[model samples]
Target: MQNRGWLVFTLGVVGTLLALIGIFTVMEGQGLIQPRTIGLIFFFGTVALYAVVGLMVSARKVSDYYVAGRDIPAFYNGMAGAANWMSAASVIGMAGTIYLLGYDGLAYIMGWTGGYVLLALLIAPYVRKMRAYTVPDFMATRYEGNVARSVSVFAALAMNIVYLIPQFMGVGMIASRFLGLPFAWGVFVALAVILLTTFSGGMRGVTWVSVAQYLILLVAYLVPLVILSVRLTGNPIPWLAYGKALEQIDAYEVVHGMTRYVQPFTNMSRLNTLGLIFCLMVGTVGLPHVLTRFYTVKSVRDSRISVGWCLLFIILVYISAPAKAALVRNDIYQNLVGTPINQLPAWMDTWGKQGLVKVNDINGDGVLQFNELTLHADMIVVGAPEIAGMPYTVSSLIGAGGMAAAVSTSLGLLMVLAAGVAHDIYKKMINPNASEGVVLFWSRAVLVIVAVLCALAALTRPALIVQMVAWAFSIAAASFFPAVFLGIWWRRANAQGAVAGMITGLVVTIGYIILSHFYKIQFFGILTINAGLFGVPANFLVTYIVSMLTAEPSKEVQELVTELRFPRATRLIGEEG
Candidate 1:
């Protein structure tokens, strides 16, 4: 009865908010509200809702802060996981990547989706059985010392800090473009809201808030997609109807002497494409923020069940992405490609003012050409509604969705970073006798400090959002994936091997990223984004050899691996505190 009542209340809140957004959208269309006014309303209104939920369910206990009391239902956990997985890169940059890279962008969809399969089948349930609060906590226990845990803490901080920058960048992009705020101010504004939402409830608050974010982002993404689909192909189903748009796009490409839209290996070599896919796939399983979702569920079974739910929720967005790319491309090719520079669509100028869309006439013909236009990949999805000439309300809704995606993922990443520092570093290593209150206070402090640092880094706009996210994935894949996989499966694995493997992976992957990206060094034709292809193999080989050389783990540790493999209603390893 209690669960049902909570469900009813959640539905009521979501329904009421959706209805309000719909009314405002119509009002904006009818000129009853200014676009800026509605944009502000959508942005702050959603943030305020998340803040209220956080405060209402604020975490008071250590367990609640770390793992949400381990009582979250599978379905909601799945929803939260999906929202957490759909970072700003997935929400704002994915469709834009599809737009810019054409068929090459499908590598991301395939890699990310395939990674979940690995998580569900091989990782999530076992990790849940371990009952560890953070991945570093699991490492410390599994490897039987602080050494492995401390190394994992370093890797977690590095990867998550890199990941956080892009999320802040997405928030800044939305605020600057939609709310008319300066980019730097926009990042800090969103940071303040994020800190407020996360500072109180920790994972407990973030879990429920993520569920809400998933709903908003999903609706915001699909509404404009369906509308554009109907406009272009007279079909409401974008996934099926987008083939018509693709046909038109292909013909336009042929006529304009551009690369075929459906063709692969145009921009990147085949080997680089395959390597990128591999990195993304393995990296998905290695991500601490994503894997932490499993820890919040009721049991190992719920953890497995939630993976299924997460994949289902994620597929809805992934499949629609190609259709959005096709439809938007078709619209641009048909309507905007050959227009006079002075007569270009108003949306072009709007996005141009933000430095997202650029047009240059190399021939000085005073007309736009396909070759002269450069649209930043991040702008494609956010600007799609305006590009389609949809109502300002639709564009505003996308901004809200973009913010939701950025904020939801940021919260999860922040939790991982804070927990890594507070639980793994401070309490476990620095001050083992510290009280619960002290640990929690430091956790909240770390959240603020880390967020501010990332926001400042985001102001530099270091790289494209998706590129930075891929770099994070590469780091995680190299450092965490092998250690966790070996720790769970191999009885011979010890603290020495795990630490050695993690260090090697981090060194190799980070080195490759720096050399290949900055110094333009080439290695087997693999792109910098897929540096994990080199690192994963190196880690696995080093770990296997090192474990064989080192003393085997204790008999007790072997028994723990057996327990993780065959789950039952047994007491978890770390539950006793």
Candidate 2:
């Protein structure tokens, strides 16, 4: 691990950067600078900061490009992991989902956090000890077959591309809404920022930039909650203020005849809640971007510590999310429920411009009835400052924070995709003797290509961003979790079994999702979101049944598994065969 000096220095740099942005924001509000310019400067300037750092720390060697030379300290890796884990879904969509579904949405929180616990206990140490550069690296070595590697690589790429679409699209959406830029410009900016930083530094660059992003996003997310909490309950701490705020909300609900917002399980079935939580938890363990972080640390012990820190940082954000949802829901009801449509707050009008908040009088009444107001799940975070009457400066900070969350995750997934192509596919299977420089060059090339492809996809304005994010998780859980778990723990697991299991899991999960999502066909009247439930069991059964029916693994494959079972006995890339 490096000295603690860098930690202190980095914090100082972040503090200075934020202080300058804050000052510029005030000046803009006071007519010293153009509002749009300040927004652009602050938002993209943060990206520039990351780009400079990434260029400075970027890898010259294949090892560094792939895994940051395996020298990242646990603390820094933890921060990076948190930033990676909390994608646009967590930052922008989580609060919105909670606001829409009330207690039922808490499943996302429980499942995501609980999955980290599972990661720490069941997965991280072994993967770190195995010392694989990519998820497929571990898969190929353990299963002792090129076929296993190819399947794992394809799954990683598919899941990652699906994941990246929403994040990049979020960048464009946030930029358009917050900076008054066109959506394409927003996406171009995101692509440029990602290419400049991640393409330059690779995993090393992503690691440090993610640490900076964690700071920006958390502060941006927490600031509005703190101010609103003080206004609602005379406390700045959001969690502490939630109970009192809920009381006020309940009373407001009674006055307005609102039931779904206050009642638990009113918006979704409890079975769906269980299903969502289960999928997200297992999905967390299965996610390549999250698991890849473990491979970047200095030691297996550091990897474990990194998970602990990840949970700590993630929990802080997760707990505050419910507070944001409750406060925003209450604020809207108390302030806008009975106001005349013509006299509503400017924030409502501005947000309405984006079609995020809809106000209509279904009964032909002039008053804005509670039932007449419709809030999209995203408005809770994006329009939060305006809802609370905060300054445009704070709103700008929130926009930047949203960008941080989106860009940080996009950078990580882009790396995963690039590595999947350049390292896993090209060098491993195509040119086993490829030079390190050639591999690094292809990795950088793929990074730019992916950014462009994802940008084009983002321009389609996919309505399924959040749903796709969940789909990514569910797919990852179904396809990778069982194979990975069995490969590490069960010696009888063979290449044939893994191949069958992964293919079955992917088909089952995707098949169920297509039928339910496109056709609304419920299985045996089960309308709940249990696609993962069907896929996961089928995976285990097929893998076990197929492996037993086929030949057992070679002695070398068994030896590799035994080696991975202990941290100290293993070396990096412990491929016995």
Candidate 3:
């Protein structure tokens, strides 16, 4: 009910923002205004709007702060989930990979989108039925051991921080590029927006803000594609127009005597592709921030329906990403491939200044050959509007969308991490008699501290955006997925087995990733495979064998699992000693 008013206000504000941006574009194009100035206005304007909303819906009660009082409807929860799941990696990274790798890049789309199906079937319903505020709470309660909960809390914090810092960096980078500000200043802006929105309302505010973000980002991504599609093939649907563009690209590649862009296994091996897919699919079910979304809905039924809606929203962008990539690739080949370096389009000059696109006369031929140019894939989506000769405002919109994706996911991850500390460990183990006011105060305090720390870490310039994400998912898949899946379905899964499984999966995956990424070492050549590949199986084997070797979970724990597994019978909330 509270969201209805917020929804109406958001619609009006977003519409006004879009209209103003269009006007600014017209002015800049006609030489009446500067595009960078317009960009600054739009960037700060949108972020300020979110800050205002956060303050407006700020919560007082612990229930409202933590899980929005568990009152969110199925549809809105789905939208928020979609927004939370589709982080900067999904918005910027996927299209960029598709642009660079062609057929090989489709793996990201397949793995990420397909993971929702697994969430719908395997995890969402049962997790929601548990009625816990955080994943560690469920893991601790289900296993009947605070030790298990403590392990989960540490794991959740590690994974989420690794994930969260990159998003913070992304937000900073996007703002810096668009407004021509220092990267640190852009990071400060991001920190301000995050603290304002998240600190004000907690989950209650974040859920609605996520809905607004999803709408803004989806529109920003789609508008340019539709325009480019119509220009290339007289079709407004980008994916459908991709068919026409693909034929043209293939012909152009033949004329240029280049490798076909549509060929499979061109960028990565078949084994790596399939391994990546498996990691992503299994990884989705385990992400603390993502799985936490199921807790916001009112019932188990809502949780299931929400996953369906989340997938629907995600597919809209997933299917379009490849098509957008193909069109951009074709556009470059058709127009810029044979042009002399100095005579290339303005976009080339613009992005080249940023080091995103490089051109060299490798053969001393003075012309920009297809093979002579190297592009960073992140440019594909961010530079697409400019590549298509759209107004500068469209490019600005893309930047805003990228920021939205980064901040929304960061907000969600930050919340779960705070809950892991304040609720799971602090209240549960450190001070069981802590009052609601004390718990709420510490939770908000932890939330703000986490945001600030992540923002500062973002300035440290960590790993590549997409690579850091892969590590996070691999960790989740290796550590959390096996324990979560087996604990609910296998009655013999004792607390000892669950804890041991988590440790095995986590150590194997993280250790392999460290060796492969940092030391460039591939132990026995197996570490070169997806890190989750080894970790997941190790978890299953160790957990199953250990549980079989040990005693079953206590009768009460077994009965609790049965109740959660089948929602037709009894209900439990909070937890029993």
Question: Using Cα atoms with residue i matched to residue i, what is each candidate's TM-score against the true structure?
Answer: 0.96, 0.95, 0.95
For model 1 the TM-score comes to 0.96
Error of 2 at 20 (Å): 3.1
Candidate 2 matches the true fold with a TM-score of 0.95
Count of clashing residue pairs in every prediction: 0, 1, 0
Candidate 1 per-residue lDDT over residues 1-577, each given as its tens digit: 6467558756865687679768987787788988788788888888888999888888888999989999887877888889999988898889988888889888998998999999998899999999899999899889998999999999999999989999999888788776677888888887887888898788888988888898889988998999898887899999999888899999888987989979998878899878889999999999999999999988888888999999999998999888898898888888887899989888888789878898999999998888889998888887888887788778888888889989999999999999999989999999999999999999988999999999999999988788899999999999999999888878788888889999999999999989998999978888889989989999999999988998989887877887898778444566544
**Clash pairs, model 2 backbone:** 58-201
Ranking by lDDT: 1, 3, 2
> Tens digit of lDDT per residue, candidate 2, span 117-141?
8899989998988889999998998
lDDT at position 468, candidate 1 = 92
Best by lDDT: 1
Q: What is residue 557's positional error in candidate 2, in angstroms?
A: 2.2
Predicted candidate 3 versus true structure: per-residue lDDT over 1-577, tens digit per residue: 7668656865875688678867887798789988887777768877887788777888878878789988887777888888898888889888889888778778788888888888888888998888888888888888887989999988887788878888988888898897678989988888888877788888988988888888788888888889889886788878777988899999988877877889987787777777888888888989988888988888888889989998888898889899888988888888878888778888888899989988888998889888899889788899888888888888888888888899899888888888889899899999999998888778878888878888899899778788788778888888889888887777788888889999999888888888888889975444333788889999999988888898888888888888878755676667786
